[model samples]
Every structure is written in C-alpha cells, then in structure tokens.
Target: MNQPVSGFSKKSKAEKIEWLAENYLQNNLRSVQVLKNYWNDDPSLQQLHDDFIENTLSNYYLPFGIAPNFLINEKLYALPMVTEESSVVAAASNAAKFWLERGGFKAEVISTEKNGQIHFNFFGSEKVIEAFFEEIKPKLHSSIQAIEKNMKARGGGLLALSLVDKSHILEGYFHIHATFETLDAMGANFINTCLEQMAHTFEEEARNFEAFQKKVTYPEVVMSILSNYVPECLVRAEVSCNVEELTTKHHEGKHFAEKFVRAIEIAKTETRRAVTHNKGIMNGVDAVVLATGNDFRAVEAGVHAYAARNSYYSSLTHAKIEDDVFTFWIELPLAVGTVGGLTSLHPLTKLAFEILQKPDAKELMQILAVAGLAQNFAAIRSLVTTGIQKGHMKMHLMNILNQLHATEAEKEKAMEHFMKNTISHSAVVDFLGKLRL
Candidate 1:
C-alpha cells in the first residue's frame, strides 16, 4: 500500500516525479521517461506553464487544427480548434464548405449580460429585512464604484443590483443578485472582487441596522461568487438554403431534409438521445472554445443548464423546412472573452485570435455559435444519409493503425484495403494478421 508523505509539494520537480513514479506508478521506467520527455526545453517557457498550477508535471498536448471557410456575418474566417477527436475538425470544415455556396452562416449576439450573487441568512422579520434592503441597495452599488471604475471606463461594468428574498423557499435565505456587462473579458476576477466587497458592505450595514441591533444575531453572509449560468449572455447561429440545394450525391434533397428534421425531433423529445446529441454540438463548441483559450467547461455547464431550462434536457440545434427551404440553427448561452485569461498569455491563443481576424467578445460569441451550428449540421447530415460510422471510422483509421503498430507499408496497404472494404476493428486486425504472413 502506498503511504502519503509530507513536503510532497515542497519537493523539487524531479523529486516529486521520482516519488510519484515509485509509489503511484509502480516504478514504471517507461512512464517516468514519458513524463520527463514532455517537459519544455526552454526553462523560461516551462516556468510560465509551471505558474499556471501547483505540482506541475510536463505539458500535455492536444492537436491544434483549423476548420476553414467559416463565413459568418458576411465575413469569412478559419476557425481554430484544439481536440483529440479525429472527425470534429473535418466535420466542421465540411459543414462550412457545404454552406459556403448557400450563403454561409448567419449569427447574432442575443445579449451580453453576466451575473453573480451574494447569499446570506437572516432570522429577522421579512418586512424589516425588505426595508433594510431598500435602504442598503444604494450603498451596495456605491461600495463597488472604485472597483468598477476601470471596467466602466471600458464601457463595461455593473449593470444592476437587486435584493431577492428566497426565505419562502429556504428559511432565512436572502440574496443580493448583481448583473454585469463584461465586454471583452470573462471578468470572473472582477465580478468576484465586487461581490466580496458588496458582501462585506452588506454585512457591515446589517450589523449596524437599528432592527438588527435590536436582535442578538444579524444576517449572516453565506458566500459571494460569480455564476457560470449566464442565460442572458447568449448568441444564435443559423444556416438556411433551398431544400433542393440540400441534395447530396447519396440522397435526394427533400427526403434528406425530412430525415434531418426527424433526427432533431427525436433528440428534442428523448433525454438519452439529447445528451449525446448535445455532446456532439459541444465537440465543436469546446474545440473552438479551447483553441481560443476560453472556458469550455463553464460554457458546457451553462449550455447544458439552458437545455434543461424547460425541465428536460434536449437538443441545442433545431431544424425546419418551410417554403421549400431547409433551415438549421442553435441558440445557447456562451460567456466567452477575448482579452483576458490565457488569450493574452498563451502563444497559440494569440495566433487563434489573429486567425479569427481579432474579434471582440460579441463577435467571438457569434463565431462560436456558428461553429456549433455548423458542427451539428454536418453531424445530422451525415447521420441522416451515410450513417455516422462510415465517416467517423474512416477518420479514426489512422489512430487504429498507430495503435496496431503498423509499419509504413502496412499502413499504406491498410488504408487502401479499408477504402474498398468495411472499416471495423475486427476486420482491420484480421487483415493485418493475414498481411503479416
């Protein structure tokens, strides 16, 4: 059994790796070498990565790829994507190309409001608490004026603040809900700072309130933090073309459109299917979000929550056929920024923005929504026509070849064979076995 040791974090990098390898990795020589091999050669660059987190190991990597010809808002762009999945970038690129001749994608920013909350408990009379909140709301806004100055100067800052009484739901529970317009930054730090300050001011004033002073205990602050669920910060992206234009070599346009709409309908009414349906959309959203150095996890949480806003999770993408036209679209909350976090710090993130023509926060939101919409269109198009496995397995062939340790000649032969034959793990393995003979 392994035992916990003291001073693990205090240990040097080599020492920490040594101890981890011995205790946790069972002294696997290859594992230790693999970990060390990923370390950066430049000490300065390594230090930059090290500063990102504690107990830093060597850098982990994902493929950075581009999905080109994404036309949004009458402008063309090449979207950067970072992912391990094989077909995501390909699917997105194919979708972008498919729509390019059909007028590409249309997108818009629905809103740009983010929010946070300060939750507290008060055992005082509800009427008294309401009066105290009315009096203290102005002070709460004034308390964060200094903090909001820089943000305000940039045309972004606190938008509104209000007191919410949740005591009916949870006894003694009340909250101060605050909204913001962060402009070009995912202002977690800024919002968090203001929330903490407001919480401080709230408690201080409550402690001195005459009604509270009359009681033995006053309102107790639970916590202050920014919410990732920014439903108001949303964007919509869509593609539309004549149903006749939707025809592929494999399927007729009218039939294809009918099947595509049915697939979305199934996802909308079915929870299990919706989860995977939405996950496919996130495959595109997350890839672009990661490539741009934005918070994909937060975006995922907010989007999933939005999907369930009607009390049941469903597809994020919707499709319709009207007047001989086929339309597909997606609308979801996305809180992304272009000026803060790793956007400025990471070299690749900087390149991604340059590739995107340097969009602001709102533009980035629109572009991301388009990427997601395009991805879903490609996936549904494939699913309703050729089936998902044919393309997915074709893209996955190289990964399987690498895992099987096929030589150059074997890989070339395998690729040609799979093109003519079914591409399945068992079939590939059997063919390789015979080829080795």
Candidate 2:
C-alpha cells in the first residue's frame, strides 16, 4: 500500500522520517523513537554525518576496538577494527599476541597500479581502428594533463595506455585501457575524472579521423570508469617460526604444523571449504578496512576476483612446513587509500589512521594484508585445535546474553557458567531461565 513520494531528498529530515514511518513503519511510535534515539547529540557532528549521504536517518554504530601488540616489519602497532562480530576483535588480538613471540609479522607491497577503461563501439575495420589508436595514444595522455598535474606532482600519474579490441567477445566492442599510479590517495575520483576526460577527447578525435570519415563509422563511447579489480595493486604478509615453537598445551608442535598445512591444502583444493576459509580471512580484512574508512566492498570484490584468478576459487592464505619451520602467509590485492574519501571525513576513521601511526597507502596495504593473514592464522589454528565453535561461541555468549536482556548479576554468572559449559542459544536461554527462577 506504500506509495512513492517525489522530492523526498529535498524534504527535511523530520519530514522524511514521518513519511517513512507512515508509509513503511505502520506508524509505530516506538520505531520512530528508535530512529531519533540514535541521532548524534552534537549538532555539528550530526550534520557532518548527515552530509555524508542523502536523506539522513539515525546513525548505525559498530563497535570500534583495538587489537594491540602487532609487530609488523620490526615496528610495533595496534590495529583499529570496526565490526559487529563478537569474535573478530578477540581472534585478531589473540593472533597478534601469538605471533608477537614468533618473530612478529613481515609485510611488503609488491605493486601499486590501478587502471580504468573507456568502452566504445567501433563498427569499422580493426586495422584502421588500430592505426587510429596508435596515432591518438599520445593525445590521450596529453588530454588529462590538467587533471593529472597534482597527482603527477606527488610522484604518481598516468603510467600507460593501450587499445584493446574485443570484437570477438562482443561485436564492434573496443576500449582504451589506461593504467595509473594514484599514490597515497585511493585515487578513485582522480582516476575516474581522468578517464572521463580521456573518453571525451577520444570521441572528439574519432569524428575527425580520416578512416572513420571515409568508412562512415565512428567510435561511440559507452562509458568511462575505473575498475575495482586491481590485481597489480598487491601486498604480501607472512609469519614464520620454528615448528617446535608452535607447541601448545593441547597439541605437539610437529603434529600441529602438519595438521595446519593439511587444512590449508584442503581449502585450496575444495571450493566449499575454500569459501568459508576465505570468509574467515575477510572477517579480519574487512574489520580493518571498515575501521580505516576504505571501501570494504571494493576490497572484497577485488580480493575474491584474485582468489579465482587461476580459474578456480581457493584459499587466500597459504601454509607450509619446511626444514622444521612453519610459515603462514597471504598475498592479495588491496586497493585501499589513506588520504581520501571517508578516511578524512569520518572522525573514527581519522582516529584509526592515527592509531596505525599514519601509514601511507602502501603501508596501509601491508597492514591490511597482515590483518587478513593474522585472522586466517587464528581461525585455522582454532579449527585444527580446539574446534572453531569453542572460542567463537564463547565470544558470542555476550551477544546472546544481551539479547536475552540479562542483568549485570545474571550476565556475570552466565559468563562463568558458559566458561565451563558448552554454549548455544538454547543452552544460554535455559541457564538464564533457571538463574531467574
């Protein structure tokens, strides 16, 4: 029965909320109250959040936490994380502590290249189009001089340009592919702007080309945009220690290392296992990506694409035991930036950067890779040892308790009881029911 309302964006916040409440929320007063309750108290701060997007509603908050004692490349750091998952921060902190004594984590940036494309339709001879592209390639670079000036001054700019003919895949399809170095910024806007300019110039030049005029065919631009699949922007992070040093109370070092390597191999070979295995890695990767105000969705897309680059999806993390040493590492594409987008606008994001010691884009990529590696190590370590449920459910207990509306005394008792007993939603409910009785 809800009807679309025009000019919703121009409406005041209160008006928008009222319309939404009436049209969709069934006029629930409690729902309306809930929306207002989450609004920031500080007027300036609320406005800042409001300006972030259109039709601002109440803020949705995630817990911002710190995983301390991360030693990457001989430098100590405490990573900032934002996630609703109860076990993520606990798992990351545990992994950081475990690796701290194992010579810490080592990370390095392998490359920093991003690219975009200008898709156009060229219904003409391929040879003529090729010749025209070669002649105009230099002009394509020069067309973006004004746009690339600032980026070039910072030691990053257009890297290369090429003509790609995909008429075989889709008839009359061709594109101008361009590569770039965005430096410290995520460079999405910069790259996109440059692409738009080049696209404009490309279409303009096509009209005057002798071949196009003679053949009565023109290259019609479809779109110009940057690609999120940045495989060339990669980082590798790893941790290694003697096999004997992996010994814990539950398992011997040799057995544990062998089992760990086998688990990773299973993930690599099996798609079902690989999906969940990679998801655990993202639990860590996404937390830091969100905390630092980078686009987690973009990072996720690019990373998953990389995992499937070999024609099959596999684990992002790898493990090996050689010469009495167990090494665990992950190499993935992370096209994140430290100086632009929400990184500067969001207060918590800014704080996250400060917590990370203000790393540049490359350094941030290393940190993100290390976070994913640490998370995977922790998850696989648990899966091969205590079983994932034991620690994960224990961490999830607080959420269940909060859901059941347990009081302070009840929560304290529940924690102690679950520490000794297995945890499940029904079990927690039963325990609280008995305690209340």
Candidate 3:
C-alpha cells in the first residue's frame, strides 16, 4: 500500500527532513522514495546521502532499524543496519524476534582493551644511536614498566612488547598491547593519549644518540590501531520459546540445527558460497558500524584478514538447534568506537548514537556482535530449509516492480503467492493504470 508521495514536493528542504524523520519512524514504507525528493532540496540531506554513497561504495543502499522487541538479560537496543544484500535486515530482525519471544537478549561485555606502539627509527647516525639504543633499552624497560604503575598495581600491566623492522633499516617498531577494563568508554582518545606519552619520552631519550635523530614515530605509532576484539567479550544472547510460537506448522528444531551446520560447512568450504556467507555476517556488523560512525572499511579489512588466517577462509559463526531448542551464535573481529572522529562529525551518526542511549564502547561492541550473529542466523535459517533466493527474491521482486513503475495488476501478478510466474513488459503495460509507488 506504499505509494509515492508528492505532498512534500512544495515544502522547503528542512521541512521535508523533519517530515521524513517522523514518517520513517511511523513506518511509512515508501520513505525511501520520499527521501530522494527531500535530498534534492536539502543540502544537509544531500551531504548525508553523498557520505553514504562513499561509505557503502554502492549506488544501492537501504537503511532499516532493528528494535529489540523481545529482550533477554535486561538489554534493549535499536540496531540500525545498511546493506544491499537481500534478507540481511529481515534475517537479523527475525532472529532478534526469536530471542525476544523469550526474555530478550542478555549481553555481558568485557572491558575495552587498546594497544599502542612506539616505532623507533635511527635516522642520521646509526653508530651513536646503536650505543644509545642499548642505554635507551634499560630506560625503555623502566619507562614501560613505570608507565602503567597504577594499572600494574591493579593487576593489569603492559601485556607484552615486540620489535620489528620496517624493511632493511633498523626502524624497529615497539608493539605495545595494554589490556584495560574500559567499563563504558570507546578508549581511542584515551589510548591515543597513552601512546603520545610514550612517543614523547622515547623522542627525548633518543637525544642520547647525539648526532642521530633517534625519535619515536608519533604518527606511525598511533596510526591505525588494532583492537583486542576478543570474541568472548561479545554479546552472548540465548532464547527459549514454545515451539508453537515459531511457526504455523511444528518443526523439530534439532533437525533444523543439523541441517544448519551442514549448510555452514558448505558455505565456508566453497569459495563462492563463502563470499555470500561472510557478506551475510557483514549485514549485521556493517550496520552497527555505520550507526556508530566506525569505519566499516577497517572493520571489513580486519574481519576478512582474520578470516583468511587458516587458509580455509571459513565462516565467522555457527548455529544449531539442540534438544528441542534453537541456539544461534557468531564471533567477530569488530574494532568500533563510541567516541571521536566520524561519530562526532556526522549528523545522522550523532542521532543514531543518541538512540543507542550513549552506550560505552563495550556495550556498543556487544550490540554489534549480536547483530552479526543474528544476521548470520537469519541467512542460514533460510538456506537450510527454503533456500536463500526464495525469500530474497520476494523482496527483490517488489523492488524491481517498483523500479519498473508497475501498476496494481502487474504488481498483484508478481505478488501471487501460490504460483510461480514471470511478468513480461507487455503484460506489465496491460496491467498499468497510471501507477504510483
């Protein structure tokens, strides 16, 4: 029943945005079409649209919100995800519903842990710096040891250190990993500050090298950090529901689980299947990343690189039904932030963050982890039984017909559920009756 609207055609840009937000929340399904018109008039909206285009790298993008309708473990989240892959949004939304039908998702997050580095480069003179490197070693040892005195006193210390050369030069990089319990912070700024301190001290002490400019690589040291995104710290959500609630017809969940495992195995082992499979996982991860203003690109890099570690390039998650029950799970290498950078600059990102109720990074990561698992759950659940295209094509058809500018009759022809039929362009014309969206 969603029709293309023209009522806002006359409104100013700001008016349309205000109207779009209200109607979008109200579930007016054709808000996307309305958005195009609004974007034409509004500079701010255009900026958002442009940014999205750059971020997603696709001409096609869709945004939908996942509300934790049924919550478990006393947690509620409005998960927003954007992706073109079919079934992703529906799958995640459906999975969350499955959990919510019980008590809702219970999520426990480990404190955030950040690692910093100090890259030491011997620029001018190697001989002086070589002797100073030895002196600096003892100083570096004490400095590192003394840096986290209070943290060490609290039983968390500089976890470890590694020195690696950039190329042939003696450009050694100190790999510092500090595990902290950031109860509710993003820790990027905090971690960056910590790294800055080390870099400064390292620079000053490098003066002992005299002629050689032995300095700590500040920019490189803090460049792009690698997060300690332990999969265990992820939001683990479990649900229990009467079999009757899940389907119109009764299904033995255990059998479904077995099939799910096999499907996942196939998905991971096969190269083509794995692309779609991991893409399914990103359905959840990317959405949360977009909402949080985290770099989805970086997230994608880390996840894919990690996925390649075993040479098998396997799936990131697994699911099964056990003992008349259904359980779903996914593990992720998600490095996201709750503060700084894009989160602070983007308007929609700011609004989305507020909708999340300003959760600390730990809580935010939990939300993302759950979304990834939930999305994966949606994909495998369909593939094991109905097949992926069956459901996906349903939505795809609707979108295609809309784009084709089809009429009510042609739309109904495609919508007919009992029989599988294709509509020709001629048939579509016969059905056309001054159609609207």
Query: Which candidate tops lDDT?
Result: 2
TM-scores for all candidates: the values are 0.98, 0.99, 0.65
Worst 10 residues of 2 by lDDT: 1-10
In the range 268-373, model 1's lDDT, one tens digit per residue, is 9999999999999999999999999999999999999999999899999999999999989999899999998999988899999999999999999999999889
Residue-level lDDT for 420 in candidate 1: 79
Scored against the true structure, residue 320 in model 3 reaches a CA lDDT of 54
Report the CA-based lDDT of candidate 3 relative to the real structure: 0.59
Which structure is stronger by TM-score: 2 or 3? 2
Cα lDDT, all candidates: 0.92, 0.94, 0.59
Off by over 4 Å in 3: 1-64, 67-72, 102-106, 119-204, 207-250, 268-272, 320-326, 407-413, 416-437
lDDT score, residue 245, model 1? Answer: 94
lDDT of 3 by residue, 78-160 (tens): 77665665566777778887767655655555434445555543333334445555555545546655555655665544454
Winner by TM-score between candidate 2 and candidate 1: 2
Question: Residue 60 lDDT in model 3?
Answer: 38
What is the C-alpha lDDT profile of model 2 across 1-437, one tens digit per residue?
77879999999999999999999999999999999999999999999999999889889999999999999999999999999999999999999999999899999999999999999998889999999999998999999999999999999999999999999999999998899999999999999999999999988998999989988999999999999999999999999999999998889999999999999999999999999999999999999999999999999999999999999999999999989999999999989999989999999999999999999999999999999998999899999999999999999999999999999999999999988999999999999999989
**If both were scored by lDDT, which would come out higher, candidate 1 or candidate 3?**
1
> Arrange candidates by TM-score, highest first: which order?
2, 1, 3
